[model samples]
Target: MMLTKEEERALSGEYGEALSQAMRILVKVGEVLGAERLVPISHAHASGVSYATIGEPGVHWLESLVKGGAKVSVYSTVNPIGFDPYSDIIKVDENFVKGQIRILEAFEKMGFDTSLTCTPYYLREPKPFERLAWGESSAVIYANTVLGAFTNREGGPVAVAAAIAGKIYEAGLQVLENRRTDSRIRLGFRPTDAAEWSAVGYAIGERIGQGIPRLEVPPPPRDHLKYMLAASAASGGLAMMVIEGVTPPKTYLLGEEEKVEIGREDVEHMFGSVEDADLVFHGCPHASLKELVELDNLIKEKVEKEVWVAVAPRLYERANDVIKSLSKKGVKFVRGTCLVVSPIDKMGIRKVATTSAKTYFYLKRRGLDVWLVRLRDVASA
Candidate 1:
């Protein structure tokens, strides 16, 4: 792979050991992926922040980068951590809290925004054709498909490296020619809400298995589209998709695609009954402010069940009025964390009811019986 003089110097250790290591990692990754050269990126979002997911080794790696003088060269953000530091409702081991705090400090020392969200696009909306080095499967696919940005599904360390170097290996979705899709899906039914859209996305992912597809359905609301993209990425590792009027023209191509029809029945099986759920949760990708307001409106009376909603800290702060109103109605708003990465099992939450397929997928893998419900039903579940 070819490198500019500055890149070469950085790789050779003239730019400090931390930057040299970061450059080496990017160069090695690019070479392995057949990237011809490194390209500049506008932004980066690193995942793997949850202490429950990465444990001590991840913490050590981040601390090592901080010790080596690593600092971000571009605007960068981070994914959700293990749990909300301010929430007293959710309980976990003291050791876990300490580990989470160490990880947070490392990110802060390295100049990352520490947004603590899977949906960094909500924090900083990328323009069309903007290049990003982002982790978190859902965010990668959303940036590529919905926002018309260029980014592959980056790993946690790779994204952090890209932030430090301000460059990424130009391969995968970064190259326009590779964005062409030869698979098409026709949706016979319009999804009513986020949960149904999530089910449709899960079904599409199950069928396509990482293959990008052109959707024939009308563009749903942005909030619903968010859940669909998140579910597809979670289930199928999908990085991009083309929706006729939604995805920006010239950013994607449709070939002689094999057509498949998807209807209501196809996604019916994806929704599970919410009868015995110990906890009702929402916001796997973290709820947007609009969604929070909608949740507030949907619950007409105080909820009888334990209801938890996850949201980005920034959004949570902005929705103070909505949060207080919902709080009176028995809604607990958890900032900067979600059920997927938090130690809910340790908190005695066995069966979960959520409106997100991505949450359903991860929690079920952790031995909890997860149920998929509609957005309106979540408040009452």
Candidate 2:
């Protein structure tokens, strides 16, 4: 991979051992991916922060970087952990807490904002055409597809390395020519809500694999777009897609290839029948302020089952009054963690009812049964 004079110095250990190692990692990754050069990034978000997902080996890897004096050279944020640090909302074992604490400390030492959320865009919104090295799947898709920013779905360590070096390999979604839409997918029926949009995304992913699709659909709600992106990432490993009106037109080139049509019936088959669930979860990508408010309004009535909703630390702090009111109605607001990474099964939550296909997708991987429904339906059920 080609590098600037400053980048060469970083690789040659002029900056320090940690930075040199980070530079080396980027160089090797660039070479393997056929990147022509390194590009400076404006922001980064590191994943694999949860002990439930990354365990002792991940902790060791991060702490070793910290011991080598690694620190973020750019604005960086962290993903969710296994549980809430300040509350008993996610009830995991003491051992789990201990391990998660070490991971949190390591990130803190590295100068990362411990937001503990998958939606880093909520913390610092990226501008169109801005370069980012984000690791969280949902965030990467949102950056590339929604905000028109440039980033591929980075791995945990690679994102951290980019954070320290403030640079990433110029390849994948960073190049404008690479982000062209290869196919046309038209929605036969409009999605009614976020859950339906999520289901549509799941169906699309299953059908089109990694194809760069341009969707011809109605203007979905903002929250629905979040669910759509997360579900697409979960089911298809999709890094980016083009929405009809949302995505910037100039960012990606359109092509006339195979035309795929998706209808409501197709999405209906993907959803299983809803039954009584042990728990109800929301916020796989972490709830936005608007989502929290909507959820709070929905659950003003009595709750029959245990419900958990996770949000970013900033949202948790800013919406304290609203959160406290929701807590009174039996809605537990989980901070620093979401249902995807948390050990909810250990807490006797084997069956989950959720409004997110992304949540359903991840939970199914853990041998948990999920019932997919709209947010209002979940609230009323």
Candidate 3:
């Protein structure tokens, strides 16, 4: 691969140890992937922020970069942490707090924007064709498919390297040829809610795993689409999905791509089985302001069971009144953390109900019994 004089200098340590190492990481990744050159990125969203998930090794690695005087070179943000920074709806043990604080300090040292949500696209809107290095799988799919931006499903360290260097290798989804839709998915029914959308997404993902699948159905609302793609990625490792009307046509080519049809029965089968739930969770990718408001309305008649709504701090602030009102009615608001990353088992939340298919899949792995339900019907369930 050819490199400009500045890039070569950075890799050779002229830019200081931290940046030099970061440059080396990106360069090596580029070489491995056969990327000829590095592409400038408009943004970078780092994942693995939760202490409960990343633990000591993650903290140590991040601290080393901070001690080396490392900082992001471009607009960058972090994923959700282990707990809410502003509020304490969920309990945290002493050991968890000690480690979580260290991780937070390291992130702050690197100048990561504490928007602290999986959905960085909500914070810094990506222009069509803009390049980004984002870690969260849901965000990666959304950026590529919905916003018409260019990015692969980068890992935590790779995204951090891109942040420090302000660039990433121009390979994978960054190239137009690689973004081609390889298969078509025909939907028999339009998903009426997040649960149905998630079910359909799961079916498509199970049938067509990695490559792009063009949906024949009309585009659902952005909010619904977010949940659907999140579930698909969780269930079947989908990085990019092409919707017939939603995805920008010019970004992907569709020629002789295999076609598959998914019916209502297939979607129902993917919904999984759990009749009753002890607790309800929302916002696997972090709730949007609109979602928070809708949740508030849905829980007007408080039930015996606890309902946890996880959201980004920015969204919490934006929808302050609604969230506060819901809290009064016995709804719990968790900031900067979702059930998937946080210690749900520690909280004694064994039986759970949620609208996110992604959350259902993950919590189940932890041995929690999760019931899949739509947001509107959650109260009745």
Q: Whose TM-score is greatest here?
A: 1
Residue 243 lDDT in model 3?
84
Q: Which digits, one per residue and each the tens of the lDDT, describe model 2 over residues 140-182?
A: 9888888999998999999999999999999999899899888
Model 3, runs deviating above 4 Å: 270-275
- lDDT of all predictions: 0.90, 0.85, 0.84
Q: Which residue segments of model 2 deviate by more than 4 Å?
A: 272-275
Q: Which ten residues in a row have the lowest lDDT in candidate 3?
A: 267-276
Model 2 scores what on Cα lDDT?
0.85
lDDT of 3 by residue, 1-381 (tens): 788999999898887888888988998998999999998998999988888888999899999999877999899999988877777767788888899899888878898887789988888889889999999999999888898899998999999999999999989999988988888888877789877887777777778877888877777988889998988888887888888788876887775689799888886744543356778777877888888777777765774567777888888878879877887877788888888888878888788888888887888889988767788765443
Candidate 1 lDDT over 1-381, as tens digits, reads 999999999999997888999999999999999999999999999999999889999999999999999999999999998888877666778999999999999999999999999999998899899999999999998999889999999999999999999999999889998999979999989899999999898888878887789998788888998999999998887999999878988888777798888889988876765567788888978898889889989999998888899989898888889989999999888888888888889888898888999998888788988878898887665
TM-score of model 1 (CA atoms) = 0.98
Winning candidate number (lDDT): 1
How big is the positional error of residue 242 in model 1, measured in Å on the Cα after superposition? Answer: 0.6
Q: Count the backbone clashes (under 3 Å) in each candidate.
A: 0, 0, 0
